[model samples]
Target: MRLLTVLYDRGAAQLIRAWRRSLHFRVVSVTLVSSTLLVVTFSWLLASQITAAQVGSRLTEAQKQLEQGRSYLEPQFRDRGDAADPGLNGFLRYATALLVPADPTAYYVLLEPTNKDFLKAVKPQSPQIEDTRAAQDAVPADLRQTIEHSRKSAYQYVRADPDGRGERPFIVVGTTVNSAMGQYSLFYLYPLDEQVDSASSVRTTVFVAGLALVLLLALLSALITHLVVGPVRIAARTAQRLSAGLLDQRMEVRGEDDLAALATSFNQMAANLQRQINRLEEMSRLQRRFTSDVSHELRTPLTTVRMAADMLFANREDFDPLAARSAELLQAELDRFEDLLTDLLEISRYDAGFAVLDTEAVDLVPIVNRVVERLRPLADRANVELRTVVPDEPVIAEVDPRRIERVLRNLVGNAVEHGEARPVVVTLADGDGAAAVTVRDHGIGLNTGEDKLVFNRFWRADPSRARQTGGTGLGLSISLEDARLHGGWLEAWGAPQLGAQFRLTVPLRAGDRLLSSPLPLVPEDAEPRLGPIPPDEPSRGVRHAS
Candidate 1:
């Protein structure tokens, strides 16, 4: 039973593997089935011929023996004209002695009409000199009458001793003889058992030959199928490698068949794909350089205008109320424009694969404190309280302090804008191989399921919200990009009427990895636990505040 189970498992595994890796199974199955049908057809024809020939030979042999039996009995009756009892017995003994050795299982019986009275029939057994009345109905009446009518010779096949206890099969050949007492019938019985044995042996031989032929055909079919499907297997493997980003993969084109043409086509396709990729890469580099140049060019003029505006605003008391207000608005607008340019430039750099990280061991606690201090004035004006939580020891990380500081300041400012006069919390902590800073605000935080979209460019949870402080909506987007450049995590968690949480997790050392964030981004006061965020929402990007 265990072996049977193992066989079943092996068969199932083989089928699965063949389905996955081999195309020859289908080919082999079709070939074997066809071969099996042909072999069966041929075997059946041969079996029919063999059976026919055996039966014909048996019939021919039976005819020859019947002719010989009649010839031998003709002379015996002619010499014994009207002779009676014991002389006929002597004649029968002589005939039996002549036919015994070649086929010992032959029998002869002689019957006199009416037993010298010609009124009643008599029968005799072996070694009995006088005729007896036993076995009078041993033969069928039709056959007995035919024997009586054949005063010359007749032959028939019948059951031996039909009315006796056991019925055996034999051929009966008969002739009638006239004697001194009356006319008598002489019959000989020959067994047909040898012919049956010959027929059975012929069938057995044919069956064995058929089995061998079928097995041979199956083996040949398998080999042929394997050869035909081998190239297809190679092509499938090459296609798989090409999909896995191996642009140089090529198939061996050895023949002039369709498979070889397919291989040639695959190689050409790979070459074309590689060329397109290279062209796109070159175009991307040129675009990045153009964006950077424009950003630099704009920065110089914007800086000059900013310094001039500050100088003009310093003496604003002499100007009219309209002019003074105009000056302040110009400065604010210029600041927002500059922030947008900077983010666009950074994004171009990232797209061109030019962004690089400058790593150093710096404590995150001081960074968070500085960001909170910078945003404290804005928080107070907005009637929002700002709180900071820092660990005792230095929660050190390898990061660009300048970029990291800019990111924290953006998160804090964003919280203050939406805090709705509620307290905002900035928490920092150390974790295994990483450090995290979370900024939380108890405000009408965001639209339902818009936490991830908060970091996308120019995204707004509320479009009607005023940008009084002059913010370019690219701060969180740029921050997220910066965090990704350092292989860190910058994610948000928020809900409607609850609060918003933005967590920035950075590695402790250069190239250090993070399994998970130490602080959770989603606030505790959200209504639903988790919900799907729509990607096509109107407020689906970063909101950068300058």
Candidate 2:
């Protein structure tokens, strides 16, 4: 029973989902439901109108027949003398025999005088009804009261035995026939069984026809939607393939209709996009090649320049003050230039997809400490304090130690370079099969939205402000690539003047995906309104080049 319940629930859920998602299903279902309601309303109105018309027609004919029988019968009552006359009962019986129709479903009733109580002693006041002994009981009291006083005829519907033993509905129309002898009420009991049967059959026919009409409307709606939705579905699929690098995907055009025109326009847009993408690809390829060639070509000259600069520095004490100063400046500039070349070569390798990871199980604490310790001199020169908040337990992970060290150096170096003489904190944490490192600096922090822009190659916050360490501006971009290569995340968070935090999270096992990081991207001491980034969504700060 429990399994059946679960199966029913699953099926219902799938049906509900399909109802919400499918345009064709929704359109057809709505049309069917609305059409059914309309058909029901119209069928009810039609059936009701038909029933009323039949009753009206029957009533008019019965009234006409009553008039025809009364025209000649009133004269006989005039010649029969006053209410005290003898043989009046016989006269009534004779009048009934003449007036009653040949139809078996019909009958007649005649009642005695309303006044002249003295005549009641001569004859009984009991009504005279034709054909049946108990037919007098069928005339309702309310109907008799109206007919007794009025000259014009009136009708009332009642269920009564007209022919005795069998009960059915009837329309009793009664009128007054006046003469010198007395007043008389003549009533005709008309059985409505035939009209009832006719109305019932009509309702049934209308209902069946309405049902058929609803089905036909639904079918037409489905067919129309199919013609429109079919091409739209095909266009959607073609667009998907085009986005997935199938540059030649195009829509098929048929006759010169609106749909064909739409297909032609779509094909033109796809072609234009393909051409633009091809042009961009070619330009990107040429740029990468140029960088690689330039970096390689400069190495030999850079080496020769390095050797000469080193020799000049060694012998600089014997030269004049100006000469010694120039030699020192040249050596410093040469070092900065070489670093720039190295960064460019690294970027070119990354762009060409030549960079690789060499992984092994190693403790990350040592790597963090090494990066911090190596950059301590730079921190001190910048008047910035360096701090580490690593756990006593070794955070072991499968990673390329060299690549991790490089990423750490880039993060820590940036912190110290811009720490504004404040403390730069490096916290290493591990949990949930992942290891994370956050480098935070209370410095001239990044401006709003600069957290993402900082990772772009050659991007600088204040480009005119001279860099003390002569940065090549490619560190963060390379770090982002390295993190992604390990199925990990490199993220950043910042608010203007508050501080900036850079988080690097990698899986403990090689090639494993990182679901979450051990440390938050937003620092604890930052602005209260700067909420921590959700671990599930890809942070905008990590959207650098692949």
Candidate 3:
């Protein structure tokens, strides 16, 4: 049943496509049908005319034979049988009878008017037609009228015989033979069933020939249309490829027609497009490499500066008041700058596609606990609660522990800074082949379009707000890159006043791709409340459930 349904669908689709594609098929079908109808009508008219002409010619010849017989027999009747010898008279009678048409059931009948008993002497077989009146009734009404008025004349057609042995169409001629005493009548009948058989054979041959001609015409029409439409189909296919970003799509030029010109123009356009794309790709590659190299070169000196600053900060008690304050500010600014540099370098590496995942089996519960503990001080300062929700069983995943910890640390710290004195939720869950972590905050949340921009480097919802949180503005971006490097996903969902949710899902195996998320990215407390996060609001900190 399934196979039959599929076949029916395919056939229906093909018929629709053919109707759309083949204008010539439609025209050929109409023309063939019309021509067939016209040919049949014309052939029938011609057959009727030809049959009438042949029947007329046969009747005229029969009439001439009858007149010749009369000329021979009239002299004998005029002489009252005085001139001809007995043998000659017998031979003349036999010759006259023999001259009557024979094949196809022809017959001659003569009625003597002088002797009423002459009909009795030569009476036809039982159920005898007494005269032409009875014979006229045997023909159709139309044929009977023609025969009744045709004295000494002939009429021909197809009709049933009076006795109904069979229907064999025939011709009939009648004439008046005047004798000494009264007027006698003579009639001749000639059948034409054999001529009808020949005509039928001719009609059959013509019908077969006409069918073959229609088939040949249809084939020729299909071939001609296919050749004309082939180039258009090719051009359409090539245009589709170009639309799909295959800029090198080109057509084969055959002749100097309109289609060939189109092909030539298309090829030139593709060549120009290909050259432009290559140049852009080369520039992009160089830019990413330059950024990567510059970051690497600056990091070595920055690390030395950071070490020297740390030494001075460690002994800041020996310095003067102004010098100590200066040292504190300088060290803090340096830390922020260092974070920015590190994020830029990581971004460069990702841009160059050189970031590789270093996977190892690690317990996710410990990693989450460590990040929360490290950020606990910051959360306390922000007056926000910190909590965690982790599974009792060890949730082991093949991930880069360093990157994972960094991502968690960034999410927790951001939530601490933005969570507006409300609770923060951190959830961990394991699945068949993957694990998920969700960080949610009842803080100032994102606007409708800010979910994607939240991960862009240096993107801030309110740039005018003070930098009290001390973030380098690239932390979220870096965290996103880190998750991606480990073949994981970091996605965010936020609404006005509804707080924000961020989910990080990673596969259990090193290179496995996650197909399902165990943790939901929308906070459970989001419904019924809607508002945008304010720029100047201070936030409650991260939460942990362990």
Candidate 4:
């Protein structure tokens, strides 16, 4: 049943799509179907009326002839009486002879008394009715009963195949006649061959005419639909080209009609859109240039200030306590400022398409282990546990090690800062032409709708929270760019109070498309580590430094 429903739904959807795609097809199909139904219904009703009229007229004529034959035979019967002047056989022969017509349009049957054995046989008027028994049995039992018991006439329609000819419709009129020969049932059979032929001819003409009308209507519908849908189709194509950056694309206006007006309006809209897009492109270019220049200009001063701060910090012990403390704060702020400037410069280079990849074959397991070891001290200071799960075998990939290492440092540092004294799990795996690394932190997870925004430059998840670790807010954004440059993917998934997971997937061979990742974004062991950790319970999966 489900399969049938699916098939039915698919068929219906396809039909609807076809109808929507072609206006001409829709118009023609509807016209043909409706016209056919109308024509068929009219033809059927007309044929029924015509057949009824013809049969009624034939029945009336048969009744009149039957009455006339009775009028002519009654006197003869009365004159002959019970004396048996002309014997029963002679009377039957004379009666049949009088009723039988030369044209053979009608045949007569004479049924004698049931008790009489001598002339209890059917006598048909024409030789065409070869089977006398069949002719006698043609009269329906109910009709014959009515005729035998009453003086009133009764008639019915029946099928007859006289002389071995194909069956044709006939009317049998029956009535009882009391005479000297005894009580007899007389029936007159009338063949309606002419009426039948006329009806068939009418039906044939109606059917042909209906078919012709349907075809003509279909053709007319097609012509009208084409005239209307043709210009619309052209305009649709023009709109598609315009959206594809063909700013000059426009529809030809042929006449002063609705379609021509539509074309004019469409062209005007395209022109306006092209102007707006050009202006926006100019503005974007200027903004990128300005940002690049500013970043380049700041680097010299930042380097000079960094050198001075390094000198002062190297001699901080010789100065007063307050002075040394001040120098240390200045040096720390300068470092953060320099890092921000560098991130901005990197972003500008990316926008200007100046950044290039320096890729090489490298095992990712050692890189991940190194990043964890380097960040282990920071994690300890922040009271966050760092855990690593790497395959025993080296997971090799072609990548720019510097860029990947920077991304990993940013991710691990961010996790450690926000981990809320909880364990942060970092996992790596390689399979199916790709390698994946996932950093999962059980912390105050991302709020609703923050997953996508987290990758946006300078977009912070919480602006009010104090910074435990300095973040320029361009780390995830730059990481996403680096992943894309390697023809890979970087995605984040998170829910409130459920922690966040950042997954980076890269192809084993640089520039090779990565179809799937070996590891899932949501960790397999997530449920067990979701709640608060017990104070006395030793951390189970921690891998320190190594």
Clashes of each: 10, 0, 15, 0
Best by TM-score: 2
lDDT of 2 by residue, 180-262 (tens): 76777777777788988999999999999999999999999999999998999999999999989999999999999999999
lDDT for model 4, on a 0 to 1 scale? Answer: 0.81
lDDT of 4 by residue, 173-279 (tens): 97877777567677788888998998998899889998999899889989988989999999989988988889889889889998889888988988899899999
Clash pairs for candidate 4: none
Query: What TM-score would candidate 1 get against the native?
Result: 0.58
lDDT of 3 by residue, 223-268 (tens): 7666666777787888899879887788999999887888899789
TM-score of each: 0.58, 0.87, 0.61, 0.83
User: Lowest-scoring 10 consecutive residues by lDDT in candidate 4?
Assistant: 537-546
lDDT of 1 by residue, 1-546 (tens): 999999999999998888666557765666667777876777678767775676456445544554565566556656766554567667766764443213445455556566522212222233332432223333445666876765556666666553233565566665665545557665555555565566567667766777787777777877877666767677778778877878678888888877778778878987898788778878887877888889889888988998999887777778899998888888777778887897888887777777888778888888899889988999889999999989989887889998899889888999899898999999998777878888889888667558657776788888898864566788888888888877788877666677778888888887876776676555444424545444553222232221
Error of 3 at 367 (Å): 1.3
Candidate 2, residue 343: how far the Cα is off, in Å:
2.0
